[model samples]
Target chain A: MANLTAALTALPAFLMVSLLLLAAVAYLFRDWERTVAIIAGVYTSGLAFWFWRMDLSQPTQMLLGRPIQLVAPLTVGDFTFQVQTLNAPVIALGLAMGAAAFLLAARASQGHTFVPLGLTLLAGYSALFMAAEGPLAPTLLTPLFLIGLSAVSAFILQAGRVGRVAGPLRLLIPPILAFPFILVATWYIDQIALNPQDNQPAQMAALFIAFGYLLLLAPTPLHSAQTSSAETAPPVALTLATLLYQLAVLYMLFRTISAFPFVVQDAPLASWLEWAGLATAVWGGIAAFGAVHAGRLWGYSALHDWGVILMVLATAGARSLPLALFLLGLRTISMFTAAAGLSVLEQQTGGLSAASLRGAASRLPWNSAAFLLGGLGLVGFPLSAGFPGHWAAFQIVAETDWRQAAVVLIASGGAIFSYIRLARILFGPLANRSLLRERPLSAAMAAAILLISVSLALAPQLLDGPVSYILSAFNG
Target chain B: MEQLFAGLDFFATETGVLIIMAVIGLMILTWDWRVALAGLVVVQTGVAAMGVARTGLPAQWAGVQVAVMLIAAAMLAISAVQTPTSRSLRQAGNWPLRTLAVVLIYLAWRTIDVTIPVPGIAPDMAGLFTWLGLAMLLMLGLSDNPLFSVVALLLWFIPAQVAVAGIVPHPSIFALIGGLELLVTLTASYLILVDRLPAAARRPVMTDVVFPDQEPKDWGVTDDAEEVVDALPLPGFVQDMVDSGRAARRSQPPALPAPNSAAPALPLPPGGSENGETISEQTAAKEQG
Candidate 1:
């Protein structure tokens, strides 16, 4: 057993390689939905566990009387994949989210490629976080390229049999636009390294980097793809893909700031994040109010919640990341719960349009309730999982500027208002129509999700230990 | 040692410019899917050649780029072939508008005269690339068909890539870019193929009909509603046509079933069918009416 453990520790990049290989296996067994889901779920959970238990401080340890070399960086050819202590928890969070998506796919339908494609994306993300300088630096430019490629892959995965390709196609535009700017920024960064005295290169680098991240962050006008995708793509796939990309981008943002302090000192990056957050949050809410489709409304609500998290991120840069992550953790629960219910609802109803879902609650009561409560959680309504984090964030923002808090509160009302409208339609008169009944296993899954949400709402303290551990990664 | 066949020298020449322009123009102007795809192959080949020359990229890398482009074009062609309903050899609709747009884009590119600051590339080559980029962008904006849009998008990548190569000509970078292009092509092909698939394959057939408990709406005027149609107070010509049609229908026997068939020998729903019309025939007639 000790020898086996040592052999595994001797290969640090083993997890990434295994993830990729497992993804291929999942693709091969995609016809067996249960098998694919099981493989994906177990593999991701295993990865999360590995990251959680990793002791990066120790390079070598005695295992069964043999010295086992345990290092973070794994060199493959010229490229090195390192486990950055600061990014481990974030990676674990992403993996956990992926695991949830996979396990849910066991019961719900997230399309044919959701498991394999999702696992592939996770592998790319892990490689990205663990990458160190070789032929290309892991800093910003190489990741941008990887993101562009990932976006193309995502576009394919999201395009399924659904005829709406517009949303998936829109996702391709931002990365295409961001790449050149970051490429130029990298050149400028190299120039700065050669000539340290001149602030010109740093300024140029800052400007270009800002433009790149602005597009990558995808606030306001650039947010249509996300909303459109939610309406068209499978909910679980959308949740996993969106969360994975957002978390990776968040980490990239922090890493970029750490690498170049002038980004905050010389550039208006802080203001950009703050204003962008405000606009995005407010717009998300207002948009939600008018969304007639259940899927679109769910998307808008998430967008609004994302806005609040962004505001938290803008508060004190790295200092506020833990709070933001806490909110994101709550968001993961809300999204997973809602996606589970929504996927089942879409499957039975054949569509998510408001007219199609008339009196859906009368047929699939448990799933309906799950969808409703989960959506409400996104808007941070009282008695929901998201309420505590949102309320805390609001209080924290109000301490610095009460008006900002008020804006967020007022915007949140828009999603709440939308949810209320959705609730009426769901529970209204049956209208002499019939819908497919929810499966027993599906109901059980939804019940489990509901229990988790209620438990989190009642005992918000359950998140403290994880959040604090994640925060410690950044504290260094 | 003499430097033989130095990079991008051909692209700087007038002949190279004309060939590039002709290929792009053919791609944008042609309505034929086959012809458009042919133009795409030519454009990609030229891009690969130019990148190899300009950046001194390895032959293997250039081969990879060319091979990927060929496969992408083949995928698009296969989809086009599979979709029999796709129009072939038809004159492009609004050709004048497309032509004018193309001309206007080219004029704008020339008028702006903006210098691209890509290192180690000639000025003429840069100008040519800029023009090609703008033309591809225009094509992307104007296209409505997914196949054509994908082709334009792929073409746009060439110039952007050449610029990137000029700045950082790493083999890994080129390989990554090639892989992404292939993935995009695969996705576009899948969408095109699926779009042309039968309706049942796209969405659940159950959603096509109203729930069993809900009554389906009757939009057309039935025999019982003839009076209502007559009372609409339509113009004389229209009313005459309707009356004539009804008279013609009355003169004819039932569209289907024998005059002494088993359909009439059996019990029939009251007022639903006359003569020896089968239930299916009656339903068809009702639908037609």
Candidate 2:
């Protein structure tokens, strides 16, 4: 165990070394893509298992019962700070995320050159967050995450361009706008210099990060910039990838928020969140009011999903975090399923215009079912994975202010209208030629959607353990 | 009254105003001009809702003022992205949208008063409203497909999150990176949505735009070739970089056929192949630059 911790503590440096090795080899040998992905995934799974195993008893952290170098400093300008490394579980998570990215890269039409790199960065981030001793960890992770997301975004954007609808301007700009915030946040990290003894600054820093991530979850103005680079057939996995980031960001929020309820649970802050959620939901819905594109409709539903989480997280309690985390899983399933169906539809027809896809469902009823199911999830319809989380959120909010709950519900109505409208479009009486030409359904896409929907439906508790485990860190 | 005239006017004092400006600049950079214009309107709304340096009713109606600002923003968004064929219109089309960007910026800055600050949460109302405006602007600007537009608009979250997280080290840094993350996300989304277009199967303006699997034949002749010639040249640095078979050009592709209507506009058969990255597009971009 001690050796494991020692190895794990040195993991960040090891990851950097590995990234170099992979990058060197990846360009020359494309065949290693699958192997890299598998290793990354297994690595993450291992970390996750370790996280569970180590923290099994209480809110305890025993890292292979060993002491690794607590901190290593990097000097930029006058600042000399060592980056902190995290525990096995978080490192595992990085591995897992990387693994997932690896799998996705492999599944993509082109073997993603960026996947291995992204996984390494994500692993580094997880390691920093979970094991690092000082403020530098979060700061380091911030830049690393920015780089990782950008890589993912860039790859996906390239994929989208390759797919068609090239010149996706949306892909490049949002990251540029976000760069300043990162620079500023990094500076703060340097200033705080949180010693290993106290996790307050790091935790609080994360809360702040989460607070910002709430908007990220929704992606309002820079929305086009956010998703302009969607190039795959079923954009679900890609969407899921984004959601995974959101999950991490939200987890950062919940745990941190719990620790600092004074700052987090304030009326003004909560009010801002509430109104923002309402406005975002309503605004996103109105935006989708006459949406013609099926994918666009899905995007609107996504906005609604973010709004739900925003509202739920606005209220502070043990339940809120669990539900918020749970909600993420549901959102993942629902969003991914819908993206898969839409991917199929897009593949069948070339575009997603309303006039063209007048009655697509009548042809591929099963895929349509998946699409509808995803839509249901978006609106938090009963039995859908999206349901329970929203319900829990609403239930909590309603207890305090029914009006707020009503607002959230009204916002949700936009998504429902959208879904119903889509169904109407899919089964419409328009006389235009079938905009959709049938391709044999992709078993992978179908199975993926079915699995997402089924898991969302059957295994609500899959989230329970993780959520509780994360929440335990809150001191609540 | 003393607080109102403290000389640190809302526009001058609030950091979010700058953030709003940054957001607008970024939106213009990424989205179509129409969406960018909507972002401009939100900036105006931020000014109005947040108020001028030291003007307007500084108290008693901050929420309503902000709401009004948001309403204006929403109205502008609807007008800008609304296709010519919609249920009904409270306003005319092209001209109204054309005027929105600069007009809203002027309106917001000239009106609303955000003299008061929300302690512990730096930047005050001006900053707060800017975040809200940024989100609204995106939601409105992305009027192409509600689904797509909404996501694009959600890019506003980056700034909004920045606001809540404060200008402190952790949140600011995280939010900034979040902004970039958003940028990548929106761009990817744009790519994803466009790729979903069935017109893809027909032929590509560039040979490289073809899905590796479906492989678009010789389709994009429309004005692609002509346009390519007129494109701006790539800078020397980029020009030096290697591209596909084609040398980097400083001009646009010549007039190519519309990839959508030129081939299969009606049928959407979603599909593709491996090696999804477009070697040609990158070369084309470099050449066009």
Candidate 3:
């Protein structure tokens, strides 16, 4: 009974991953992978809330009273970084996203045979994150790395040969172009390890890496592709990948920042980041205005969200970073969920452009609601998880430069307006017309979307705790 | 050792007025005006990118002055052309003449700072650029003409990215400019041609329901309070012709079934077949679905 009470109390922190892993393994071959994934997300999200509320550590210090030391690579060349895994929140998110993706696939009527692999992927990421010491080894990292690799490979394998995406070669180039830069950069970094040095060069390198990913994302006209290739992905798979790229990469980069405060402290670098965020935000907004496609609109909105976060982080003091981490975690999860839900809507038309959505709402009411609320939540619309982070960020800005913050809002208007446009298309007046009506969304898909929105609205605090944990861990 | 490909490197100082002249001459002699125009835009953008991006420019302004002179030479070639080119290729007045105008404008605006409010902070350099870009996008994105919008998008996006990364002392992102421009231009073409599909209304002449004899009583409009012929899924030109033909019913109005509010019709429908009534009824019902 005492154990049961402790488990119930701990539901927000660990139950989500454990339960999800159990269900994923149990139903790895079941037809309800879609439904199962959603259940997992709910538990995982609850875990984030529990962490946020209790923040159990006291006299919180890095290493929790142990002297922190950077593990020196036995040799600068061919050094191995390793640790046993233990983080609860990150594992929970990874599982939640993985499950949510599986659920999305299931919602689309695919078999859930892939659930076990996804669960393993979650476990791998968890083990890396949850360790008493946060250092990771290349060997231990292999499994999680395989998640990204296998996700892409599995999709191609499932596609099985008849590649009909031949409409525009120009449309296909951006995503292809992007991979090489990231792959090359990651390869180069793995080749060499520097002394735990100052932050400036590291910041510069991280900025380049982030830009490499952004190039692949191709938010606006600047991209070489005519079509957003991301539209071809499984909603869940794409969501999981995006969460990994946008927030995970960001967290990794932030962790590295502590080793180089001088970079962040450099006024020129700080000003540059502010400028970059502003540009990204405004550019995203403009693109949103011209966004005639649902996926593109959401994609641009995500960019804007990234910009907002970047701006805040750029301006924030070290003490303020916990808030930024909190927001990033909340949005990464929320956006992944929303993007997954949008996948269902995309299927009815076999596409996801703004025009494709003509009369889409009648078939997938709940899914559309999920896309809408999720987009709003990601953008920090009034009461969503985004709002609190944005509000706090603004307060921080107001102390320094209220005028600039006002401008940031104006630039962010692109996200706000585009989301409104998406809503209008999905649930507007009965003026929408269609010729071949799309099939209605599956119950699992609809349920998953609703759950994501509700979770985001109900308990963003769940996210706050894990973020603090990560920060505390990094504080060493 | 003799350096073979040293000239090819961007850092090589051998690049000068001769190179600029050669490029301008190539634009005039071998290239199409559109290519020339794009080239000109590229050159100016490259210069701006150099100043704004961390890429160091030629150590001396002498090269820049020479480059401008060559640009003037290219403009002269464009103005001298007999054939008009694609608007995108209008480099004649754009480079020499337009460049002059921009210079004058800059001279005037340099004295004044145009700042705008943004979210949560003061207008830093990147913030200022963003405001400018947004304003440009609003003007261009909302334009009725597709081509104009594309041009505006270019104007807005490039400067915006440059401004954002510029203020940082160690700015480094060239692929962003090249790659993004390619994507934006191509996507616009796709949207216009593929996504914004034009609905075709193909029908033979006899399908027109208008009477051939007298001015037709009630103009084929029934007690249903809807014009029978108006209900056909036809483009304006075809619908006009069908209305004029005033022909007999064709194929029993193509056997339209009772309206399912959840299902919307395809692109074209036969005339009559209870079209308007079915649409409004279906739409009203669709809301509840």
Candidate 4:
């Protein structure tokens, strides 16, 4: 048991190396089923690792009559990868999400390199969340490196597929643009270390760091990648990539705040985040109304959700942090469920445009229902998985200022209205085309995801464990 | 060789800034991809030279930077060659807008005149960084093509690269930037290549038919070429080609009957004589069909 604990202590490096190796091996296989199976296995192993580590952390759950310590940091030279209390649950959530994506991708047409690139991205994001410091600073150079990896993976997933490269190409922009500000901010930090009394360097560092993270967050104008990719890129792959990347971004933000509170306190970062997030959410809803493409509509709804999450984070208090994290967890579920349905619909309908999907529900009713229900969930409609979290968030925000809450409610109305319109089109009269039959496997997967979404919605307490787990780090 | 090396100092002067500006101008203004690629190579090398002359970065590291830039340029050059439609020599459609953008970039740089004393950089290099940043913005704002956008992204990274080299000069940072530069360039090149390929060529070859006992069948597959192309709307450039193909076929004159050949007339259906078409027309239609 001690040996196992010791091995788990080195889990960061081990997971990174093994996941990368598995990705490479997965690439060699031409069979997508085999490839997806291998990816699922990798994520499953990651989940199992997390479970084991979490079990060990509990004193009551003893191993060999001794309580083993949780996984420790593995440092080599300047690089450090640690499964700290803060990131352990996040890492577990990421792995579980990846596992779920693989399951959904089992019957979806993820591109040829989806498995390999997906696994590689999974490894990169895990490292991003776990990495405390390397070469330059924690979450600065590290996120850029991982973002670079994601851009490449996005390119591979999107390239040679019949679509615009704007989404994948836009992924390249944030890292390149953020690099200088972050690097220079690190320099300023060094200067601050030399002269602690003079707050100028710290101020400059805070402003630069805020700007850099804003770019990384990619709200509003920078959101072209997310919106455009949603319209063009493969649904399942985009969902997994987006959810994982956003999870890392959230973790990075939390860590940066912990390390440098002045960014929020001294600088105008909170206000900026507040306004930007509000704009993003409002724009998302408005855009969703105009989005003729099903995928684009989903993208806008996600942006709206992300905006609300950001608003929650920007609110003044530590409680806002856990609430925001909880909202993100719900977002992961909603997005995955939506993407699952969208993928099958895209495959059966040959496209995601409104014209292509007109009267599609009559043939593939279950998948269509999944798509509609999941999309509605994103808007925080009642009886959806995201309802409880969103309801709590709105109540919290309303406690502070009712106008902000009113604006958010109105924006959510836009998305819900769009979904209602889409539902009409989905359940509209059938055209006189050839019979389009849904595959049994696809229907089964859609049914399963729909069931999970509904079950979670019905029993929101199921999320209590995860919410508390995420909050544990904060409490400590 | 030593004299040539000394002569290279010409790029370290005020004239060097103008020369670099002109190189980027050529990249933005010129329609020929080869010319843009040439400008890309020259600008990257010139930036490295300026870094070495002003910032005091190691000459060997500057050489490494040049090599990496050259490789990126070569990858783009190859992609441009493979995607012939991207290699037009005609003037850009928006050349006037681009020219105005360049002028605005220069004006903005002149107006800003950032004079802050950066820790590891010389005071005079601020103008160069500002111009590069503005030009990069212009390029990114104007470009829709993957090849040009890749060049724009490279421009965006150059100032940062120079700044990092000046500020840190760590071997690890150098390696990291070089590797990322290569990776981004490679990905953009791939995007360019695939963006130009026919839709059928880019379509995924596999499907989600992972059953144990069932024989693989074309379920939900668009097998016909026309159907495949028509299934989903094509991108702008590809759609333009399709439209042109349709137009060319439409404008083609029907083949006149070969001066006096004894060819049999094509048989019409039993109920097809309502229009009263000539036999020669029937034969010509048959040949076209």
Chain A TM-scores in order: 0.92, 0.70, 0.64, 0.91
- Number of the predicted model whose lDDT against the real structure is largest: 4
lDDT of 1 by residue, B163-242 (tens): 66656667666667677788777777876666544211111123222221121222221232332312123335434654
- Model 1 regions more than 4 Å off: A1-11, A58-72, A141-156, A159-162, A316-319, A392-409, A431-433, A473-476, B1-10, B13-67, B87-145, B198-289
Query: In candidate 4, what are the lDDT values of residues A96-196, reduced to their tens digit?
Result: 77777676667666777777777777788777777777887676784467557766566645834853576787777776777787777778888888999
B90-167 per-residue lDDT for model 3 (tens digits): 111212332343344434444565543211222343333343343333323222222334444444443333333332
CAPRI level of candidate 1: incorrect
Better of 1 and 4 by DockQ: 4
lDDT of 2 by residue, A58-89 (tens): 32233567433434333323223332222343
For model 1, the TM-score of its B chain against the native B chain is: 0.61
How would the docking of model 4 be graded? acceptable
**Which pairs, if any, clash in model 1?**
B7-B53
Top TM-score prediction, candidate number: 4
Better model by lDDT, 1 or 4?
4
**Can you rank all candidates by lDDT, best first?**
4, 1, 2, 3
Docking outcome class, model 2:
incorrect
Q: Which segments of candidate 3 are over 4 A away from where they belong? A: A1-81, A84-92, A109-232, A260-262, A265-268, A428-452, A474-476, B1-289
